[model samples]
Target chain A: MVEIQNTPPHADAEFHHHHAHATTSRHEHGHHLLQVSHLSVGFRMYDIDAPFLSAEQRTVNVIDDLSISVHEGEIVAVVGASGSGKTLLADCIMGLFEPNAEVRGEIWFDGEPMDAMDLAAARGHGISLVPQGVSHLNPLMRVGRQVDGFGYSRAEQTERTARRDKLFSRYGLAPEVAQLYPHELSGGMARRVLLCTALMDDPKLIIADEPTPGLDLDLAVAALDDFRSFADEGGGVLLITHDIELALRVADRVAVFKDGTVVEETAVANFASPDLLEHPFSRALWHALPEHGFSANDQDHPIPIQSTAFEQGGSSDGGDATC
Target chain B: MLEALSITFGYAKGDKPLYEDYSLEVAPGERVALVAPSGRGKTTLCRLLAGYERPWSGEVLCDGSPLPSSGTCPVQLIGQHPELAVDPRLRMEKTLAEAGDVSDELLAALGIRQEWMRRYPHELSGGELQRFCIARAVTCRPHYLIADEVSTMLDALTQAQIWHFLLNWQAESGAGLVLVSHSPALVERVATRKVLIG
Candidate 1:
């Protein structure tokens, strides 16, 4: 169950000032963005001790003791088979994990520990996470208000507002969408809006979990570009997803998770070669790329990233076959 | 038969229609892939076919019978986002059961054993949830199953497995399959025929 709560502060003045200072050092190279060490999370099962009834619960370890670092301006993708607990790992990073579940991890941002950080503190200090879907945004708020609602520091308001418009232009979303609720916007537009919201905060690190799941190839690429641009602007990104093809395209380095553990971590450039994905299962995953897109050409061929306005010889009209 | 006659649609009170004068037909046992670039109303069309949303103009006829304009229709729509398909609180068994009957035999065939029934949606992996969603849709025995980008989030191996499972189920159940995908590469592999929508 999701234990969503509104709790008061666990830290005050000095901590806030510390995080505030860290937030200002956005372009400082000496500041390490995120350092996660010895992270472990497990769930409790009541049925574990019970011998009666059909109900059997076991202490399931969703994310085992793990540690990985994501530096500023780099895109690190977590890739794994389905059921590998990739999303669970992401939930921990975003501080949304269930309270009952035990999470033992040290998350440090610019040398400051985040173990005691609350959601408000995290949000206020420039950590923005884009959850899995367009629905992740508030459905009731107009898209524009939501983008403007990143709750930036009083000093950064003007800069954030200016950044907001830049993001809209980069993503090719119509200016009119600022007034529409998330439900009213098209699927792609909603995704762009969420991206804009994340960008508006100007966070040093952005963790996006499967941000472009069902979008078409062109739109998916555009969405990836949106994140890449964020990273290019000196923000680190921890992207958790299951699409290896996508990881290869957008990730600088990729981590492979299996059964709640990161079994392998390497650069995307090494993913295609035989030595890169060494595990039998990962090799099998690589071999399984459906033949159509890459059969005539090698998988290494640069994927064509079409801008939103470009004509791909496909229909712009809503009908007459363009799937 | 799954037929839409001149369907026109957009958001409520919206003047700019996303799609206007759109029509399509899928015969029984036909595996038709609706291909379109993003933002071309693929999901809107899927919602129309599944009767989750109403069309501003025109009609969606399933098996030559008119579908309800608004409200839950008999059609089952499996969206591209697996994360949204299953409720967080419900156990896998309860979730699958809500979709419809799940025979012990069907569960095993889909590789979801009895043990998996006790786990919550959050406990399952992306691939596991994807398979579960497919199983749930098939269990409903819908006349027409609309799978929108069902494999988009999956890795290559997992996606291949999903395609195989869907193909085998379609063969056995003989339900009309309306698959909407952005990958032309994927369509060529699974679809018997393709409908391109822009």
Candidate 2:
């Protein structure tokens, strides 16, 4: 058995402290960094071979009515099983949807409605994405130059180099690693490099889609720590992960996703008790946790909570609150 | 029984060996969990057990004899990444046919739909492709099975379903299982014995 050392008590205290301060301060502004309202995504698939001669087309709804928001100085974690539209949500926010994808929703950034053009313009400057697969990296390019994308001017090159070096060292990557190609790096190193690319530009919003899967526990924690620090500095983070334990550690709020929608959006404090959660799926997830003895009884039946619960703002606290 | 006796292996000559005089044994009707962090040679060990790779100095024995050098070994390995293991050009039917005649019961148990058989590997999701791979591997009815993070790409429900089927099959067939995983909770729950490797 792998013995994972307890995170130092002081780290928890520090996180709680920062969380409280950020929550209070951000609420005063009444301005959310990112707001996604009633978002839905569907794909148009065409069947080329048809006996009747006319081609058949069907729309598969991947995400439905998924609404969530991220406030400055807070990390809102989207937690769900795979194929639950978590990655779709991240891709929608990052404007990385495919050509056949049909998106219907209002995605507002910095109090302004954003379209595909606006999102394209804002990408890499106002918003950045740390994609799920490390294969997203350019295999032909050196790791360093890939991280430092398009630094044309001498002054920009100098600044980018300094930032790249600092981030590499922060992630425990060696200076020599910058010279290697994408295939040369180990799984963990490639993951860290993807992180470095997203952090290279100080984007206001960072959408990390399942960023911690291949990484070891320590490196995963370290990556979350960086996200926590980034949020503490008044940036917004939408952390998408299947590892609920890691999410609970760093996220100020948790959005429980089921099917294709947010069933419950609760404070991390609510995770202390199953009864505190408003939705049955959220409670089922809690019961399914490893500490809960890995109960498989509820695996077959994921009891959907009342639609009234979702319609009433989906907050566990029974208040129509947006964090 | 499957045994690795005094195995010494390294990727390159004159390099620090990944496994130095390592030894492990799994008897029939045993479920052994190999617990380790990523990039710690868990895959290497699984490969060695499956006879996909050979050890530099020691031998892998099945029932007190050296593994057959050719043709349908009794030890089967299911790797972590399904995309890397499967053939891109082959349809799911052909891929499953490569192993032998697969049962409809096994396909249902693994939640592999009939429609998937008509599709190629790229047409399916990672989880779907993984289920097909598992089906292909288990159809061989090997005496020993090594699963290297086989269900890591799957969701929670799929993971549970696949594990349940695998455990049931192992119980009935009296096959030795080597489950290599990073999830301690999963290992603790499913494994009869645990072995830690660096």
Kept native contacts, as fractions per model, are: 0.46, 0.11
Instruction: Estimate every model's Cα lDDT from 0 to 1.
Output: 0.67, 0.74
For residues A151-213, could you state the per-residue lDDT of candidate 2 as single tens digits? 379899888999999999988899999999988987777777887898898888898877777
lDDT of 1 at A49: 34
Tell me the tens digit of each residue's lDDT in model 1 across A181-252.
Answer: 878877767777877788776687787877876666667777788788788778888888777777877777
* Ten contiguous residues minimizing lDDT sum, candidate 2 chain B: B153-162
Query: What TM-score did chain B of candidate 2 earn?
Result: 0.97
Model 2 compared with the native: what TM-score? 0.85
Q: Which stretches of candidate 1 lie over 4 Å from their true place?
A: A1-35, A48-59, A94-97, A105-127, A133-193, A199-201, A292-323, B5-23, B50-76, B81-101, B118-130, B140-144, B173-175
Regions more than 4 Å wrong, model 2? A1-25, A47-52, A166-177, A184-189, A297-323
- Candidate 1, residues B38-114, lDDT tens digits: the string is 66788889998888887889988998788855544557899876767898889888888776687776666555645
Among all windows of ten consecutive residues in candidate 1 chain B, which has the lowest summed lDDT? B120-129
All candidates: TM-score of chain A: 0.72, 0.78
lDDT of 1: 0.67
Per-residue lDDT of B27 in model 2:
97
